[model samples]
Target: MSKLAVQLYTVREEAGKDFIGTLEKIAALGYEGVEFAGFFDIPANVLKNQLDRLGLTPVGSHTSIEQLVDHLDEVITYNKTIGNSNIVCPWSEVKDEESLELLVAQLKKVVQRLQDEDMILLYHNHDHEFKKIGENYLLDLLFEKCEGLYAEVDTYWVHHAGVDVIEYLMKYKDRVKLIHLKDGIGNELKAIGEGTAPVKQVMELMQKWPIEWVIVENDEPSPTGLKDIERSMICIKNQF
Candidate 1:
């Protein structure tokens, strides 16, 4: 019952060139939805029309906190048009413990404004979130403070930080409504379900967390990216 999607950021090179055609190919590859990054200068309505034409749903998107800070109205306006209700803050420039504390406070404001507009704000974690932000880990602190905040848990990062995906999911399942289904490469980056995420276990836990969508992504990829992704999707589907 865990249907799949792809984060367009995983194949951003293809999207930068053929936007709509790339979406067509994604659909052909059996992805039911996508997590967006940008419109590539295509008007919001045009982008929405093409996605509708292809029956693709926007499960989430990687948006900047600064933009959410400066242009929240624009952010909510476009997402609503695209049939998406989730906005993800992908990364921040903050470094070190002190900076992380400040970042959390800054992002809480962004989360609050986003919620005021009736949109869910998600924090997309990197390996750094494992470092402490306050009394708890940065991930825990952000989730605790940003009342409306949620997570787009990236399985690989959980493992990268030496945390168990199942344990983390169990601990914060309520805060996680979506997930980035990216797999690891032992010590490298590869396609989803291809590396070291305990992917099978992660899939099994879905019944409890009840994710809306699992988005396949790879920060960097092996040369056989498409083939690997295809295989990963097959692995996910057969988990039932």
Candidate 2:
């Protein structure tokens, strides 16, 4: 079964102010794991100790493509020390076929390198990725070209792009390791189970997939970050 996690990007502001304290709050709110957006420059070992104390699993970290390609060794060492094995490239802009090809080439190398270190690379998407280049969507093309590149599907964006979320996810079922169980109407973000995204249906479908984590995220938290995720967690707990 997939475990419950929250993307730290949802709580980026609070984390910026008090990283460890923010983690404590997340744990208190009943999140079993965390997907980190940044480390606030904390030492790896130190972060590991805090996570251990809080009983939180380091599900994954969103590392940039540039960091993965140029500073992979350091990125790998840091995450490994904190007991994380998934490194996600959260966002990338590919303006045309040429740029897409370049991204594919760079990511292929990053995938192999991560595999060498017993880690995996996953691509996170936004609505732009659903745009078609020729006959195929950019996202499909990227996955097709970059062998061993896994997916971290964000449900809201898939819906926002005017695609059938279930149909789209089924296409990459084998490669999807993480699900960003988000909710929103158009561009305005909402707490999970409180928006137009197919949250319930997706949660049902998730049980059948070999997904590792179901991470909750609200790109623009309403009111405050902690309160937004607290409501999200309540919905998640009710479902599970």
Candidate 3:
């Protein structure tokens, strides 16, 4: 079966309002798995039980780097209990070259600690990650410095940055385990298939890259997220 998952970030507003109820609706929509962003302050047992009832296996999450540093033990414990093995740094406040360099240095330590806990660190990238970092792009620099670090390559962001996603995937096939399967969301931050990303070729490369998961993430709202996401998921499944 296709590893079709909704990143859970798309419906962030709805989830923030009615977390478990929203999940029940998502589960009913034929999504095989989900990736968490927040827990809505629900207790771990209650959340875990709800996920169990929905047969929702959490593939990963968008956790803050600061939180991970200050509460590594608590963070790891919580993710483990929630049935998620991969805790990803969605974005950091690091923007400039100096900050990016410092962030990578810190990430090395974080990855080491997470390894000790028997989990992995997956860095999620945005359009800026492909921007020049002196000689190399920030994404490439991160890969170079952070050994054993797997990445969640956001296909849209790479496209937005004008980098060749297929080529990068080929360059780091072994290192890339997960992929965010949304299309282009340039300055406007459009929906899944509504932007300029090379949607078809990316999905084809994903299969060839032998990527593990194709997660749907839409940063902007459309008329209805479910319809856009469902169409994207359906298209990919049919391609498979």
Candidate 4:
């Protein structure tokens, strides 16, 4: 069976208000794990304790390139305390070839540092990453150059990019550790199963890959964010 996690960014407002309380609600809602977007002033031990009490596993976190570059040690320490092994770069703006190359070089070092600490770095993508540079897609180029980096494929973004998400999932099976199971139609984001991102077909294709977590995220949630994710959880529970 595949594990289900919520990218807490989906409930950023509630989380910003009460991180531990929000996690308790998430656990109560039947999600097995959580993918953190921010810490929100909660102590590592306290966060871990809340998660433990509620039977919620810390799957990973969506960190930025700034954090990875500037405060890597601090970031690693916090995640290690919370029992999160994967450090994901959610998105970055690399407008030019030089910037892309710089980012890739930085990633190689980041992954190596993570490896030393018995952790791994994952790269998450958005539609902009699909733009071709030379002959290869930018996403592929980054992975190709970064020796031990892993992929946290976001399906909605892949669809938005007009790429075959299934092909990427299969081709990079070995490197994929998580799948961002967001839904969308065109440029608008939606809660899982609420848009036209081929949720069922993607789940079917996922069987060919060894994914660790299928995380639900809504960049643009509907109504109340909590309610939005609850609906997404129901959709995932029924279908996946």
The numbered model that scores best in lDDT is 2
For each candidate, give its TM-score against the true structure.
0.92, 0.97, 0.92, 0.97
Residue 190 Cα positional deviation in candidate 1, in Å, after optimal superposition: 1.6
lDDT of each: 0.79, 0.93, 0.79, 0.88
For model 1, the run of ten residues with the poorest summed lDDT: 221-230
Q: Residue 128 in candidate 1 has what lDDT?
A: 77
Candidate 4: 10-residue stretch with minimal lDDT: 204-213
Candidate 4 residue lDDT tens string, 71-119: 9999999999999999999998865688789999889889999999999
Clashing pairs for predicted structure model 2, backbone only: none
Off by over 4 Å in 1: 133-135
lDDT of 3 by residue, 1-240 (tens): 237678888888888889888888777777877888877898878888998999988889888888777887888888888888898989876566788778888888889998888889989998877777678888888888788678888888887788888887778878777788776545775555667777778776665555567788787757556666776666665654
Instruction: For each candidate in turn, give its C-alpha RMSD to the true structure in angstroms.
Output: 1.9, 1.0, 1.9, 1.1
Candidate 4 C-alpha error for residue 121, in Å: 0.2
Q: What is the per-residue lDDT of model 2 for residues 150-181, given as tens digits with 9 covering 90 to 100? A: 99999899999999999988988889889999
For residue 73, what is the lDDT in candidate 2? Answer: 95
Off by over 4 Å in 2: none
lDDT at residue 106 of model 3 (Cα atoms): 80
